[model samples]
Target: MTTPSGDPTDHEHWRRPADLEPGQPAPRPAAPAAPETPGYQGPPPTTPATTGWRPPTVVNPMAPRQLPSQDQDSIDADERGARTLTYGIAMVGGAVLVIVICLLCSRVLF
Candidate 1:
């Protein structure tokens, strides 16, 4: 069968499985034919223009300002307090969870 473009190979005849007899083998669709026209070849590459080496210039001339000093002892104490608070909260949460589980088990059993 010819397609709308008038290409004969584009719509080669192939019988459906239902159309064949019970013992008859099914036919494969024909492979597409190669194009008559040559494949596309894009524009050729060109080398880029180059510039000579240039000396680097300093953007800022002023000396960098110093950061404020931190009190190591105070920082250590704050870290210790945060760690203790985290552990206390975790313990309280675990105890509440255990109490809830025990209550649920007692209710189910009784």
Candidate 2:
């Protein structure tokens, strides 16, 4: 492949080297000055009046608690009903899938 007229490796193509004299070094620019500002003072401290307000109490999740006897019976009954419903749906879906497979097989045979 042919090389371009302006080769990057050639020092004459560089801006800094071409501008500076052979013996003299380039002059350094002055550092920027920081702006003057007053020290930061945070917002004034506040103390809320306790006339009627009260902080919320925290509950311990690990603590063992007892449920009312009637509520426990109701919960057990609900779980049983849900399990019966899930089993009934699964059985109905399986029967439908079997019937569809038999119909397809019969059609192919005939």
Candidate 3:
């Protein structure tokens, strides 16, 4: 049998399995001699289809980023100020309660 087209070695038109050596360049994929179509019987079309079949690529859409609201900074500042005022008031109340307790204890002992 004649060797297939594009094959480098024409020796005996065929190579035994053991005859091939290692590190041989990969053989190119042979173009299909016939194109498959459903229910069509005729001489394969004269014009080759310009484009080949391609699988649809999956595109990862980027998520939209969220920016801070216009009032965020002002709201944070107001909350911090309110916390500071509440802490100051609590400290003053605790000091007054301690002084009152000390006076009552002294009076009871005397």
Candidate 4:
């Protein structure tokens, strides 16, 4: 690469070793000047507020209850009667199924 001629007038053409020619005087390096201090004094201002969108709030209406309160004795008797009827129906059905299975098994074996 070619060295720069270091001419003040030919500033545009200068590239580098950045070194001066042998007989030329070395130029003193200039101290960099500081940037000017900013004059901003306060916090930045905010934009005006505006309401955009809102969802509606709602309550569910309750259904009317029409059941009447009854005596404790009557309620207990009703529950017992229901359970007894269920057990009786289950026993009768199971007995009929067992009898039918036994009859089928005997006929097949014979």
Candidate 5:
């Protein structure tokens, strides 16, 4: 893709192949060849101890993310407001439905 001014750029056009139909699945990728282990080739060891076992240490990929206090406050406020609005709508709808039913009953009884 290039800018409207017709300048040449690095981007290449990506689209469906001309030969393939729209609904057909894309061609499957060739499966990767299995890796070979060298030197010690015997029946695989049954247990970790057989292969000189060592306890593995866990490492976190990334530190825990925390929003700033202001952001957290804003998010909390938004959540509260949404909950309040939902509850208010439900209450009003229920009240209106009950009033309509009561009025109908009064007209029928009188």
Candidate 6:
């Protein structure tokens, strides 16, 4: 682990078995030169009309804006009768607590 001229088996700092020979590849660097005003050419003739977020030519009041058909069937029949009266009062309070725990275990074993 020492090779700044201090030899630890330095082939210029190691990894030498004659420099690889089973696949090939190692050479890629050349892609940077595209700046001639590459986009947006729609509105800037001294900014006179629509600038600063112009997405509403007619209707875009922060769009998700859609509820105008009879108040969506009266709020979908009031959220489907409030989820069917909360699952019919939790199945009639689980069948009246299983018939009051089977009449309190048949009067505590008669």
Best model number under TM-score? 1
Candidate 1 has its poorest 10 consecutive residues by lDDT at 8-17
| Per-residue lDDT of candidate 1, residues 12-50 (tens digit) | 444355679877787788999987997777878887656
CA lDDT of each prediction against the hidden true structure: 0.84, 0.84, 0.81, 0.83, 0.83, 0.78
Model 3: ten consecutive residues of lowest lDDT: 10-19
TM-score for each model: 0.50, 0.40, 0.37, 0.39, 0.35, 0.25
RMSD of 3: 21.8
Q: Compose the digit string of candidate 4's lDDT tens values, residues 1-110.
A: 87476665775654434577766776777989989998987888888656875566597678988898779999899999999999999999999999999999999999
Per-residue C-alpha lDDT of model 6 across residues 26-64, encoded as one tens digit per residue: 446688887788587787568466567665488547757
Off by over 4 Å in 2: 1-6, 9-70
What digit string (tens of lDDT, one per residue) describes model 5 on residues 1-110?
54545445733345677788999998988999989868777898685455666677697488779975568788999999999999999999999999999999999999
Using lDDT as the measure, what is the rank order of every candidate, best first?
2, 1, 4, 5, 3, 6
Model 2 C-alpha lDDT versus the unseen true structure: 0.84
Stronger candidate by lDDT (4 vs 6): 4
- Per-candidate clashes, comma-separated: 0, 0, 0, 0, 0, 0
Put the candidates in TM-score order, highest first: 1, 2, 4, 3, 5, 6
List of clashing residue pairs for candidate 4:
none
lDDT (tens digit, per residue) of candidate 2 on 1-110: 65558766875534575578877888898888888888988889899788988777797468667975678888999999999999999999999999999999999999
- Measured on C-alpha atoms, candidate 6 has an lDDT of 0.78
| Model 4, runs deviating above 4 Å | 1-67
Stretches of candidate 5 off by over 4 Å are 1-70
Question: How close to the true structure is residue 68 of candidate 2, measured as C-alpha lDDT?
Answer: 52
Q: Which pairs of residues clash in candidate 5, taking residues 3 or more apart in a chain or in different chains?
A: none
Please give the lDDT score at residue 60 for candidate 4.
Answer: 66
